[model samples]
Target: MGEKQGMKGYKLAIGLAIGAALLLPSAAGAAAAKPSYELEWEGGGQSSGTVIARGGVSYIAAKAIASEAGLAISWDVSKQRAQFDGWNKSFAVRVNSDRGVLDGKNTEIGGKPFVLNGELYLPVRFIVKALDGDNVKWNARTQTVTASGLGGYHARSETHNGLTFTVVTATGELYVTGESGESRKLADLGDTIYGAVKFAFYDSPGGLLHLTVTRNYGEPMIQYRVYTAVLKNGELIREAEAGYFRRFVDNATNGGGQLIVTDGRTLELVDDVTGRVAESYDLVKLGGEEDDYFVEGVGPEYLLIRPNDRGLLMLIDRKTGGKTLLYKELLDKLNQEYAETNDVPYFGDWLRFVRRDGDTLYFRNDAPIQQDNKLYAYKLPE
Candidate 1:
């Protein structure tokens, strides 16, 4: 797939700062002012986010806040609502509305959620406190929102085929070795490797490793690159022949944008496929990564591993490298509903987060929603 699209063999572009402004109506009856925020993670990793202020309050990007706390977010366009979930709590707030339902309780955030330049901005401290109580530390001096007391990653396991890959990071190199003890170095990543590189089997061929990454630690668009590890005698011998990568901006910007692969140029990965319809609108940012999964273009924090198959859903905390389980809740709920309605015996069938269209997240499940009937769909969050 990467080779045909010219993503394979593409070189990384020079790290560039991309900024463009599209003014939005202000809550204070004036134009919203954009603010650049510096995010300091627990592990000394940092990234910048664009913030918008309303009525003297700093409305941090909801995605930025969610990423810090290892949460999932979505947008519902039809109802003009923004949704967020973490641990076991969920919240849904409608745009231009003062009240929202948080964990089944009516909580008042006072201000409404709004969009600016294709990003969703909301009351940051309020949302952070709502989902992750007492876990956030707001520093007025450094202007950084620090998140502490988070959970740890689940135990790492072997692949279905029984291959275990390990990555050892250094100042400028990554040492990758298999359980068989054949190790190799990946230095093309750069002189300094800032993110954790992740790898999995290619699925098509044996002994082929698929490497995913997010590099440069720069920008709103996180480029996910894919590399094929050529193996001889069960040991990786060289880099990908030509690394293919994909560029993903915050879903808020192009909620309905085509899922495409690009190098120096952009190309569509899906053609003639429609995005799931959303009820309300919520701006969502692609969850950023730090010390979490890297490679195949440094990847994001939130991902549906094996979505169509086992549908094991999880979110990773970049700092602690922890993985939180979420798929079981949805799967158990939906599967029970299906069995009750159809009068069938319990089957180990499952649901999955299959794809995304703009601000909408699509799932492959038997939810009694969406007339399409193939996938269970939900709006931004609520």
Candidate 2:
């Protein structure tokens, strides 16, 4: 029961330490034209290199990748090997050999490394996979490789009850790593999963973690499903029915064993332990049906909501049952900033609620292409 931070669209802060290698099969006939590949870091930075095709496999200069990816590289002229060291892991590749040593274990890099113009060149897929195991993608059309630096998925680290844990939203495989560096696979969420939000209930005996995963399907995304699961002490305790909303909105709990939920029409205070509704509210009757209401955060005396497509936020008085419009000016400013650059009207989805820490609330303008990706903060009104 303190102010819980909302983690909806926050990026995970991970470096080379957390990423591991996974071999990616090269596309057959990819090197017919001897195409070059471009490596792009999601946040910023870019590097490009000429691709060397060997038996239909693509390799790129290792020096260019190591510099851009922040990897420490050491070359051994006598041994004809290049060693890459990150914060916590190291791997070595030898020229004219497909065999490599990853963290002291011999592994197949899938393609051979070679010296071209006195520079060591390694397989593009092998270099990316080994550094960041599952967080990379190869685009054949553009001949580009996008490295998200997020381990190929969204992750969040949190500390509770003096113990730290990291939850990874690796699509189809949700994993949690404890303070002792032990990882436990919580569930296989399926392939359509795009993102997830987790809540750690530490008051329970062994702690209960609730994960709400979102999935989308169809060419135009005609359908959406939100899966809910609860895990206790690394064991899955509950895998319930589909969630009520198209988007899994934020929830608030008070350890009094009650949680807040909504289906964009009615709001319910449900028991956290037992799947029972304690109280329900007809939101449309209080306001109107024009807005697709979703819970953003819950405070002691009020609930925050984004009336979808309205370009404003509403604060509902939980005790007095009154309503107040807040943060319209902030939204307009963000929209103007986006409009000036995007050359199109600002869509409501571009603005997202990041989190609420104490009396401060945070928001981010998630413009797909923008120079500034900074978080905006607004102090709550007293």
Candidate 3:
């Protein structure tokens, strides 16, 4: 009996030791799960947008955003829906779906979708807006779609069945294959006769294409322009011209045969054929300096703008200019993490910057204080 008891005690000790060993890794893992200090922010604000949390990070839609404090994020600014990240995840998904439908990769989402560049692509507008008195609609007869939202935002476009559809955004341009078996600009009407004139989707008139003549701005100004055209029987035709605009950011569709243009501080609705500004809005006073903006047209009556700062997101009314704070205190923790990673001070009057592969924002430091070049990856609130 004594021997058996001694043996049982020894087994108990061994079991306890084993249990402790198993728990050690779990404790260490819990400690590691704590957010890293690199994700903190110093300041942030939202005009009238909502903050959305996904995968432990927070993001704000561009339209209704005012400013953010954690990290400075930049987009390609030339491509319609392209963000700072080079992956173009949205486009990739769309293209992949397209190819899957065409090539039979995997029939999952709706059906066997199509693919492009090994990435899926979808037809949804890369930039959408949510605001009061905003309307979006699609017209099948004219093959046109339109949007009208806050700040008089509007857009419209006609598409060809078997052609390539292309749209430019801040980050990069994207092309979608049309049913016409040829690649065409998604927003372009067709090829124009006059090589000098270029066209773009202006407003909801559903009229001819517009034209814009490019001017030389010398060395200081990098000319950024958008043109739309129409093509028939492989022949290009010139329809209209929208004059060169500054701070061109993104594009959106309005239901009434109009197109909306965002120039960072304002939104412009243009008439498709006449290349005229139907309406405009000054939104600079609505938000903070670091706010991010995005615009999208939903149906025929609403445009949505989502802004986020410090993990707070809000949706604003574009027409009424009313604001709403969606999420709060969600990003404060992440802001702290970002503060810990950046120790260097921001100097120099102007920082020449560029984005690489669409994900990383890089700046050439001309300041006398710093000699080493610096690169910053776009960071979101954790």
Candidate 4:
């Protein structure tokens, strides 16, 4: 009886030891697992990648970002650095360092890059900004980071007088949607590149619709031809003319005057009713070149000139013959917004003129580097 009782006790102890061995590995595995994040693109597709935590900051694999952004990447093991080249630019990052080289200039990154299990990890936002990626956002609740590749596909719309004009870039179709929520096709602007078309309501005796279309070819050099068209009463009155550059200048009737270039160095403002040159401005004498600059908007007192390389706007005062740099203030405001929204300062690449309403001028940064593209209204200097 004693022997049987001892045997039963030994068997019970062995069973308890086996149970503990099983539980030990499971507890260790649970502790080792870290949280992962999802990466979503503009195309509505998503992939999962490992998000590592270091010193309270989040880092993602650099290779993963390069893959999504279509960048070519290579590692220099001796230098402890990685090079990413794309979008006509190159960026290099080194491990254990916060300094990076973008396009051959030194720039500061958000955090030092690190390696984990043979994969290079970097701050995702820093890489995105350096590569001129589209807007990136992090959703902590969803554990997801959404981003768009450089030159992501998008549709655009403009509103004027309670009507919205929408351009579908993929199909090169233009549609006008009225206040009644009804939409109809207006024109077929065949095979134009993205952001190659602009529309404005011309104030004239008949209030015509003005359109500028740019056709581009020859990549890397980027040669383009500009075309202009006019529509009266939803019918195409004037077809697109080649190489004709013109804009409607604001006038007293809340209408616009046709501003055109008469000679290489002379800009003429023509009266819309009579179609005659009312006034002319000599661009060369005004310290501007006709080829390097284009008229963005003309006010009662000044004309806004934008550079061809998408630099700052130059304000030319008609009365005083004074030139004032206009976009520094606008760029300051944009940087503030960028710091708030993108957690980084704005990089000035392109300043786009949105429109003008009375004494207020609206502007936005268009390409290469941009924030959410919020229109900022700057009251014209009186």
Candidate that scores best on lDDT: 4
Worst 10 residues of 1 by lDDT: 277-286
Off by over 4 Å in 3: 1-251, 255-257, 289-292, 298-302, 308-313, 326-382
For candidate 1, the clash count comes to: 32
TM-score of 3: 0.24
| TM-score on alpha carbons, each prediction | 0.28, 0.37, 0.24, 0.35
> Considering TM-score, which of the candidate structures 1 and 2 is the better prediction for this target?
2
lDDT per residue as tens, model 2, 75-164: 786858888865335789888888999878999998888887788878777877776633556667866554444223234445555344
Cα deviation at 1, candidate 3, in Å, is 99
Best by TM-score: 2
Per-residue lDDT of model 3, residues 1-382, tens digit only: 9999999999999999999999999888765542111111112121322223334332334322212211112334533222211112111123223221112233233322232343322221222121221243444443333333322111121344333333332212324444654443433423221122222332234544322222223234433334333333333343222322222223334424555555335555555555466666553455443543333331122233432222222334555555543222122333334333433331111123333333232334333444346643321211
Per-residue lDDT over 1-382 for candidate 4, one digit per residue giving the tens place of the 0 to 100 score: 9999999999999999999999999889877666465555544456567677677667888876676555678878685989986534578999999999988899988889998888889886676677565567767655556565543233456777666776665566667677885777766666534434555555465365555545444433244444444545544444332332232221111214563433224556655544445688875566454444456667778776644433346678888878866555666665534433542122223456678888887878653345667886778667
Query: What lDDT is reached at residue 18 by model 1?
Result: 18
Worst 10 residues of 3 by lDDT: 35-44
lDDT of 1 by residue, 1-382 (tens): 8675565334322112111122223333343334445544443455556555588566677766676554567877684887876434577888778788887799888577887777777765565456443355555544555443332111112333444443322233444545664545543544434443544443323223333333323343233444334333444433332221232211111112222122211111221123222121110111222111211111222333221112233443333445544444444555554533532222223344556565455667543432244755533331
Q: In candidate 2, what residue range of length 10 has the lowest lDDT sum?
A: 8-17
